[model samples]
Target chain A: MTMYVVGHKIPDSDSICGAIALAYLKNQIDEPAIASRLGELSPETAFILDKFGFEAPEFKESYAGENVYIVDHSELTQAPDDIAQATIVGIVDHHKLGDLTTSTPLECWIRPVGCSNTIIKMMYDFHNVEIPKDIAGIMMCAILSDTVIFKSPTCTTADIKCVEALAEIAGIEDYKALGMEMFKVKSAVEGTPVRDLVMRDFKDFNMNGNKVGIGQLEVIDLAVFDDIKAELAADIAAMKNEGERHTMMLLLTDIMKEGSEVLVISEDDTLIERAYGKAPTDGKVWLDGVLSRKKQVVPPLQDAFA
Target chain B: MTMYVVGHKIPDSDSICGAIALAYLKNQIDEPAIASRLGELSPETAFILDKFGFEAPEFKESYAGENVYIVDHSELTQAPDDIAQATIVGIVDHHKLGDLTTSTPLECWIRPVGCSNTIIKMMYDFHNVEIPKDIAGIMMCAILSDTVIFKSPTCTTADIKCVEALAEIAGIEDYKALGMEMFKVKSAVEGTPVRDLVMRDFKDFNMNGNKVGIGQLEVIDLAVFDDIKAELAADIAAMKNEGERHTMMLLLTDIMKEGSEVLVISEDDTLIERAYGKAPTDGKVWLDGVLSRKKQVVPPLQDAFA
Candidate 1:
């Protein structure tokens, strides 16, 4: 048996769904392939899998034991397996390579498109595979999620083609309507804890010899901002007090506004002023039309740091 | 500004990433298009975006408030503001159709590939659009997810063509290695809760006048099953005691084995025996080379029920 272990780190629907579908495909070809997950799934992802009658992936943190194949997360540091035993025979990813090195000869497919799911979709298409309805739903979901329902700057033509084909199999139409329904379920604010509300999927970044923690909260109703701003302020202050090295930023993005209300909480008001060109008193800085953090916030912060 | 909301539902990387790419394409054609997320992202998805330094989607649950240019997940349930006010010009998806009524003439694109991300990639190829690296990463991720790293049954020829083109742009080779790495991550078990392990993404079905709750767990080390079996049994028993209407069934799928260990837990032992031809004593039932529930298990169960 040709035994191979495959997985994606910090798995989403695409990673999970792709792993499952590919494992199925490999088995069909009589290759012993296993699909694994590097992290826990979100509740929404769980809901999606349940709706489609699929299971969540098995969680594996690192590829330590057997032959390892990497997916979307390309950093070699994330996967520290014995490179000698683990000959990286293939790679399927949709991200710019950060720092990945393979000692063995491997087939690497890194496409600058929308999602790695698109590549998996294309592969299936090339092979003329007949996707089951449940797996088809997963492919459709992965495309919708990564492309922001075809709205992000990172999307590609291949992404659209894959979605069109998967849509036909999954029996879905009016992606906008389905997207709306799914988003409504996700953006619901009922019975959610305030801490959970403020600190979902937070990330830490270094800027100007200081580490900054950033958190994003998506809100369907802008009115929720009024109820949560003070609580969010306290949460930011607490994080700063808890020995966080640098400034803290919270982005409350109003989906309806198509913009974000940037809140920067820092001990050094000058640093906040330096980044945003306005000093914020009481540990608060609000900026309008600041949705793309990479394009808008990160660049300005990097410039200020420089 | 003429704004058109474009989106997909329960989206994966391809849907969201494709939306972004297509939105960019539309903008280049002088159409003001905004990409939106229909649901929350999974962890793997967040990792993909973070690696490429792209923003998470602006969450929009519905297109009821504005004019929508549909993408991956379009199904006509609720009408948007005005079909006349906004020309429903373009559509791109990969799922099966579900009642899309558009009176205005539109460019409809629904392909039978694995993902819409593939479509977007093909569009870039068709239009000779220069794919940015970030977009490439997103689209590749979408393909990997949707096609299960090229192992799904739902793939087509167009999907392959797009991925091949995208591979050149992203500077990657050996997709199989990458897919293996991703799947390996899914099999590692660390801090996952027992309840989560037992009940993760379970689904329900009707079989022989009985409600059957079927759950699947992917595992790399079969040795882990020895440790987890007792806990799984207890969890199953607890669920049975909860007065739910279903007989709970769990399948511990050994992806490498291309088989599963079926565990049937129910008050009705006769039903278990009737389904699998034997009552699983000591809480374990072994099945040889039974991996896919849809292909291998569901059919037998359906026949037994009939």
Candidate 2:
């Protein structure tokens, strides 16, 4: 049986890299598996794929199979449109679960870790499957990017431990230096079109029966968004017009400050204040210590809507 | 930390006994666990508990704890009402998953087996924990009850194997005779009130946003339901009046004939014909070779609603 192993839409380094590692391990363990991505990879993810000897996974909109293994996501909204029709035989994810149900009982391996690749490394060790250098390099890049070089609040001891083991396996001496090299790509949005810049790290969600879209642009310099704020706002409005978005936002995250200047757009302006308990100044709100959207943004927004 | 291990709300033999067996196994592995039940036990389950010299578990309305280990069933409708508030630490179940989500990832062990007790028995063997004779007796009763003495279509070789091994452990020389003794309890529905008879082995479900209920009464005599068909239909209508039920059915399953005479009551009689491909003759229809509600009933009914 051919099982399509894929991650959630809006592929980050962790989602794309974790899909490849799980597909590799599943094949090595005698299951016919192919790695796939649900959406286009971000620039940092593309850079990591080139740094390692791995090609970007083939993109597909939806999957229909007797057996499909979902990797790195458990949300029904984030998965492919036809995911509810497929028999989801297995899931390997690191995020909180959402409205996903299966008619048949299946294997679900979800861990509360910083990065999905950290859990994949543990799975490889559990199955006694050796991690090759190229795969290990991508796995390390995933951990580095998702955990923000061990500086993100999401980073855990498991992520750090896996990085140590995988760094040795990939023959990388200085992980800190390598992490800095990846972060440099996150700042390469200087002349990029406003639409592509905002869409790079975008994620769509269904909350309170409303489609909510949020994008993050991590940069060392926060002044870039200030220069292009009008263009960014216009792009957000255009994206919202595509249909069914109750609210759309672009998080101009100052990486070094460990915070985000969340630009807001919605039918009601007070929802931003209601969600975070703070009013926005000029259609933007400062969210301190908000690094990850899965942990930080969605929960309070859901509460506000509730 | 004490965790209350429980099954679904209308506790059957498998749900009750599997909770006991899982609680025992978890305690054997140094996890502090207590056997519990969500609702009242059925007569067959009560008989099994009395025969095995085990006290019925304490009943509770909702669990709000640091950790709770769920066993037997999956699905928010089947679980305790406040299950969403609890931090689910581990889940060992057999049925299809429903709209249940955990904020943090934990150990979820689900399999598509005839009985949840079979999964618990395998877990016992996996952990090298010897099964006690009384626990094995309850586990055997659970498997025998859920699998209809290895006759249900849901039964697999693994369930049969567990039954054989557990039979040896529980000192059961004739499993078929024991199963006959249990089915005798189901046949004793003479003095029971119509509402109680209809509600005895009932389970409520949400099929495509419509509330549906299916109850079963396994008996040697089909003439019992033929005597009071109108009373059963009236009780079903009264249950529907309680709100949120699109359809209600009671399966008059003849154990010897190995088929069910389904008595249905609904707002729309055409949906029943569309679901099972036969119009009910005065609110009663025949379903040949249908033994398991989970495997046989829910899937097609869900499809019809969709």
Candidate 3:
């Protein structure tokens, strides 16, 4: 059977590119695997794919009775609707271990690095498989995007080394310039719908039985969102009600400023205060030096929920 | 802070040996690490350690406030009492994914292979760290015990390759003979307390909120258990009540015969029937060609419970 490699819903650059690169590597060594996506790609990922001359993976949601390999995320909330029916053959992720259980032993290659692509790069070296140039290019871009050009706290030496090796294979001299270009494309939200912008990098978390939604919009400048901040807040409030979530938060992250301006809508706004020790004024607060959600945001929020 | 490496409770050969091997590997690369155990060693594991000229790992139950790297298993039911308070730094296991969540990105190397030692061998190869003679010996024995001398269904090509490499490093030309000798020591259950025998290789599972316990005793002959089967059942019944377990099962495996005589004590015995398509006769069932509890037993039972 052909195994389908996919990423979490609201596919980020790391998720989409990691799926493609991992599928390529799996085909080189072991099984016949194809890249797939659970949802539409973010503009950043789409731009990276086009820049690397690769097409978007086949969009798929239901994976019933299929052999699946997940990447980037392990939480069941981020998985496809019929993930319970699919045989999860393996997972390659760089996140906190979530409440996902399996009946059989699986191939898990989780690491503390910044991006799933870094671990996939390790897998390639482990199998002695040569990564194709385009795959390496996208994978390098994934690491850069995930690590925020090595500025995010989640970035590790492994991510940096993997990106350097991948850049060598990709024959890119100035990868940081490419990363800035990608983020520029990511920041082009002038005419994009608020729903699309929010859902671009959105994720749902099951925090102590409460559904919590978090979305990040990483841009070079936070001023891009000044005009539409209220609309974004109203949209997330509507999303909280529509998705029946206990809390919905949008992080307007200025990559240059190295912090997040968080807008939260919750049953009790004090949950955010309890998490970060900073009370929100008018449902907004500045979280200084909070770049990586997995590191800086979700853990404290999960602890507060616990 | 010093990190501790541990394995599942009622430590089997793979669990004990894997903890020692992984702690050694971690110390070679990263931090100061020590091997610890949640429970006493089984006779087979004791024999292997003695033959390898190694001491048993330090027995420490609670890992509160300690950084831990778990080996061989991932289930919270099999972990230490205060595992929730400990930081799970990583896991190297060969079991189904369990409901253990970490708050941070972790180093996980879980594989579908039969033995954790196989994955540890790969990890050593990944890091280019050479395994010591005694560690290789114990690791080889762990693979032999977990794979039932290559007879188990869970045994994979990776496991066979790992054992061969470890055997070469340990300078053991007749590892299979050593495996049989270890099994001989394992079969010496006579004069041992029934509770001790039952608890030698027992593990608890949270089967859909119900605590289910399973124990396995592999021997050369099933007749050794014939006189004590009723006593074993009574002790497991007492264990079920004391531990508030919904079900308890003991697999008296005849390794030479390649089968198991399962003695089950459950709230509803039909769960076994639903799992295996074979109803028990007087709370006992003879399952032919059932050597691996992880491969042929636990998965089906988990599914039935689900």
Candidate 4:
């Protein structure tokens, strides 16, 4: 029987690496497995894959009607995949779970570990599977990306152990350095459309019965903050016009400062006030020492919504 | 010095429990600690906390200018609280990290375990702290919610072990059953606004240079699907009218059927056709044996996007 390993929409490093690692692990157990990308790899992910000399996996837009093993996302978006033909034998991921429908025998592994790659690392460790250096590097990168280099709240001990082991295999020290380099290369704020920047690494939050969208960009220099502020402001306004029911907050954060100057465009001034006191001059609010959105911003905004 | 423990926006069970657990742990070390909720607890979380007889923490709108230990969510939204006053000694979380701005004596523990509660559980085990039955129950419930009762792609052995131990302390023999009950209660899709349903529990993804939003609602019975379908169709059309640049797909998954009937609402019909073989007669595509958005639907749609 063949097992197809796949990741969620808008494939990130964790999604991509998780698919590859699981496929490799399944192949070791004599299961015909192929790693598949559910969406086009981001440039950041593409760079990581290229560094490892691996081609991006064939993209599968939706497992909606096809049989496949899932990872990294929830089960809310299931499609018409024939599970009888190809049973979803296993799953490895890091995101919150949605309801899943599986008819055949299923051995699911869903950990809140920062990345699905961490689970694959555990699988490899448990089975003693030899990880290729390139794969190891990819796994390490995935861990770094998903966990923000062990800075995110979602990270776990397993994530740390996986990174440590993969670092040795990949011959890399100081993932933070590598992460900074990656962010620096990608943080070139010039020429990129504000819409694209707004959508980049963006997520939706339900705020006060409204669907508020937030996007975050990390840059080494705070000067980039000014570069994108106007465009972000216009784009956020446009996003609200474009059907986002609530507010759109764009953050251009300085990694070094561990703080951000927020650009918030919202129809509701109350939300702005509730979230960041009064909107600051220059369309920026000083978030004293806040850095991670998941850590600092979301909780309070969620409270306002509640 | 007192340390305030809080979580990111839309604080889930993990965020709340993690705050409590971290506070409890810090108190063991004689640190002045207080657990605060950034948002109102979801029904599922409320159920867990009520079951355990623990009062919900006070809600805070933002962590701006406060000394805080962030959990569940990242720090990208707001700045880290000014730890200068009350040394923000450590961080324990389970989400991706964003930029952090603290250089004090900080002990950051970011692991990718299934739940932040697991990290607290580890600390409990390490310190030999008695697992209070109420705390144990809440932690276990948080695990179940975050991991989707071990059905999410993110579950790990540590999560399992933690849940097992906590279940014993909580006097619950069948967590699976309890989880199912919780899910059943949470997934009930009656009288909820389609927009709110869609936005709640939604995360953003960066698609191939396009901005796309996907939302999922878990329904126990197919009867409610028609109402949800109608409401969502209008909402999607409104979203498109408001100028949402990309597509919006909503999934109404029936847990019993182990499949989802997808509602494809987009300006581009071809994108839907690319993911699902053909547009349904009612714009609703029936995906058989396909459940799990991350595994089945998103990958294929991502492929179409690519």
Candidate 5:
């Protein structure tokens, strides 16, 4: 009767918090489920867990459970290595179906919302399960992080509604200020190795048969990228040399300004111009009001590359 | 905006009723949507519609609309030709993802229920919309047809709950007798061309690069297959000559007996044996207690072919 509820590898705040919130709701209904993580915790997620006085969910590197319920992602590649052999009982995600299949029918809930946490909140409201204040806080933080405080294009009416209710339940009055605090923890670049900073928020993509990647970091001030652009470029070059991707773009997003500056290294230099409708000057360009990757960044890149 | 709501190309009772019932609910909620069909109606669906004092939804041969919402099925092969250019605003389905990608995030609700009508009923309940008797009758028929009157393995508690409520709304005190009436229309083979009878409920599948198909008919007796097995074998052989499928099967399902007799035609004879764990004598075999194609027939064939 034990079910392991987990999210994607290279865990973001939404994926991590979604697992926790969904497991809580499932357990309230007497479905024996435990929240777990697949990959390393991002700084913002770690910060949210610490503030809530909750330990991080156990890290399940390998899945050995009889029943597994995936949250926040449906990609088999992002799941446990032996997921193909395991019994997948359910999936709750907001991303594209990455060609995942089951030997039998299972419970699948995929919505087109800004964050998976929004769906989890709706599930809570649907079943009349009262969410705990700490769970509400983290869920709100995850929604705020994924939606960039409702400034991203992916935000919907459901997300905004859930955010308002969850913020009240979390005893938070100003969500914008909470969003700023989360970004402050995420965007702080303190003399860390350029390689570590680039890979922290990195995600790989397969664009028209070529491997590509984008790494984004949010900051209050946009000057963070200007400080170490050269060293970061060197690290990206080393990564490109590994043949993992043909293109690599590092995004330094200014959360306060609600915009992003993208630094690029690509053989197809015109791709960024075609995707954003502006040419990159000196291997860097500013995309106005481009704050979400799944909504704004990856889709256009996929189109241009295709 | 006029949104054309339609089902898959091979329209089943669930697909037809789901489109009609969903369109009714959406219009009540102030969304301008029309229930349309992609293919001709099956006899059982037409019977249900006629019994409910409703006309068959207008046939939509080609899509020329701005917004389209799909139900019952998710495959692009079952969608309109212009679906690639159209904006898919919402989807309420109960099947696997068919690799359809939209340019942006949109509303999607996919569950592993027995029928799409079950999900639509839940949506109605979620919105607190009362179901009309006509709509309830068709929805009940859809649930009964797809789940084989609650005898199929895909049936769940949620489905059973919906059926009970809908039966009361439809003024049916005895659903088993009503199911027999529907299946009497479905299984009526009086002088019907074997090709038409087989193709009436046929659905094609791609199993690991191999073309496969299944057709089912609900009858009161499994012995009826012995009369027309030769004609069915010839028509299916011609179907194979058309290069559509490597394996084609006709399931003579007895709703009362709760079993089926499969008349199969395959170039690979061992495949049928391996899929069902026994050889077919004279091109037919009685599969005791086998009712659901999605749950029983397709999965094993997918495994055998894969």
Candidate 6:
């Protein structure tokens, strides 16, 4: 049987690249596996795949009877529509433990690192399997994108070490330049649909039975979103109502400024105030030094909701 | 700060030895770690520890305000009462995924093997750390007991290979004889209280919001429980009512016969019937070739309850 290795919905660089890399490793070690994605890829992931001379994985949503190895994320909200019916053969994630359960034992390799690709790199080393050059290139880009070029608080020494080793393997002496190029593609907000912009890099969280939606748009400068802020807020409000979520947020992150200006559409603004200890002014809040949503944003909101 | 490594509430041989071996590996790799236990030792575990010239780990019931690494099992019912408050640093388990969530990233090493010690042995190989002789002895015994000396369906090639490697490290020429010795100690039930016998190797499961308790007693012959079957059933019934559990069961496994005679007490007897395709007569039924509660038992029961 061909086991499908997939990543979360609204696929990011780490989710797409980690699924491909993990599928490669699984094929070498255990079974015949195929790399798959749950949704359309972001521009950053597309650039990384093209730069590495690789194609995007096959898009597959429902995996009802197939064996699956999940990558990058484990939350049910981020998974496929029929994920409960699929047999989760393994998981390689760097996020907090999510509410996914299996009846049989599984191969779970979750580490407190910056990127899932970092853990996949460790797996390749453990099995003594050599990584192909193109795969290493894409994997290195994933680590860079997830860590925001080692500026995010989620970046760990392991991620840095893995990036260095992968760069050596891919023969890329200037990976930082490559990261900036990918982010440039990521930051192109012009001519993009407001719903697409909001859904790009978006994730839903189930906090104490209340659905919360969060999205991030990382750019070189926050000025890029100055004209589109109202449109983004209106789209977020529409999405919140459509999904019946208690709150919906869009983070306009300036990588150069090292902070985020958040747009909030919430049922009760106090939930946000209690989480960040800063009340939103006119449905917006400026969170200084907040670049990584997984590290800085989700945890406090989850705790406050609890 | 010392991180404590512990196992499930009713600490089996795998739980106790896995905590020790993993703590040893963590100390060599990362931080200060100590092996601890959630409850008292079983006869088989006691014999293995004594024969290996090792002491039982410190008993700790609550782990609030401490960092913890769980082994053997991950279900909240099997964890300490204050596990929700404790910061779970990591987990090394071989059972099905349980309902445990964490806000931070953790080091999770879960696999579909017979024993947690097998995965720990893999970890030791991955880190290139040498295991001490006595630790290897206890680890070998843990695999042997969990696999029923390689007679269990849960036993895999990885488990057999791990046991062979551990036996060579411990310098044990006849490991099967050692396994038999351990089982002999485990089979001793004369003059033991009924509640203690029922509680030995007990584990609780949350089956679709209904609490189900199950215990296993492995003996050389089925006749060992002939005189105590009635007493065991009564104790199980009392435990079920007191705990407000939907069902409680005890599996009297005969390793020599390669089958288990189950004593069941449940509010709905048809749940067992739907699971195993057998109706209980006098609250007892023979389950041929059912040696693993995790593999042959829990999944079907959980599905039926769902």
Minimal lDDT window, size 10, model 4 chain A? A76-85
DockQ, structure candidate 4: 0.03
Per-residue alpha-carbon lDDT of model 1 for A1-306, expressed as tens digits? 343445444455666777777776666666678777766665556766886888776665554446555655444433434443454545566653333433322334445567777877765665567787778777777767656566654567888888888878888776566655555555665577766655553545555457777776655566766876787788777776685647787777655566667677776667767777877656665576555443456556755765
C-alpha positional error of residue B59 in candidate 4 after TM-score superposition, expressed in Å: 29
Question: Candidate 3 at A180: error in angstroms?
Answer: 0.6
Q: Model 4 off-target regions past 4 Å?
A: A1-4, A75-91, A95-113, A151-158, A206-209, A275-283, B1-306
Candidate ranking under lDDT, highest first, comes to: 3, 6, 2, 5, 4, 1
lDDT of 4 by residue, B218-254 (tens): 5556676665568777876676556464777777766
Report DockQ per prediction, comma-separated. 0.01, 0.45, 0.91, 0.03, 0.47, 0.88
**Better by DockQ, candidate 6 or 1:** 6
* lDDT agreement of model 2 with the native: 0.83
Segments of candidate 1 deviating more than 4 angstroms:
A1-10, A25-31, A76-91, A126-130, A204-212, A236-247, A266-306, B1-306
How well does chain B match by TM-score in each candidate? 0.63, 0.97, 0.98, 0.75, 0.94, 0.99
Model 4 lDDT tens row, A22-84: 788888877788888756666677788887788888775544444476766534333224333
> Candidate 6 at B271: error in angstroms?
2.6
Between prediction 4 and prediction 6, the one with superior DockQ is: 6
DockQ, candidate no. 3: 0.91
Candidate 3 Cα lDDT to native: 0.92
- How well is each residue in A1-306 modelled by candidate 6, as lDDT tens digits? 899989899999998999899889888986899999989988889888888888899999889999998998778888888988988988999999898888888989999999999999999998889999999999999999999999999999999999999999999999899888878888899999999999999999999899999999999988888898989989999999999999999999999899999999898879888999999998899999999899899999988988
Superposition TM-score, candidate 2 onto the true structure: 0.81
Backbone clash total for model 2 is: 0
Clashes of each: 175, 0, 0, 73, 0, 0
Better model by DockQ: candidate 1 vs candidate 2: 2
Output the worst ten-in-a-row residue range by lDDT, candidate 1 chain B. B96-105
Model 4, residue A18: distance off in Å is 2.7
Q: Could you tell which candidate, 2 or 3, scores higher by TM-score?
A: 3
- Against the true structure, candidate 5 reaches a TM-score of 0.94
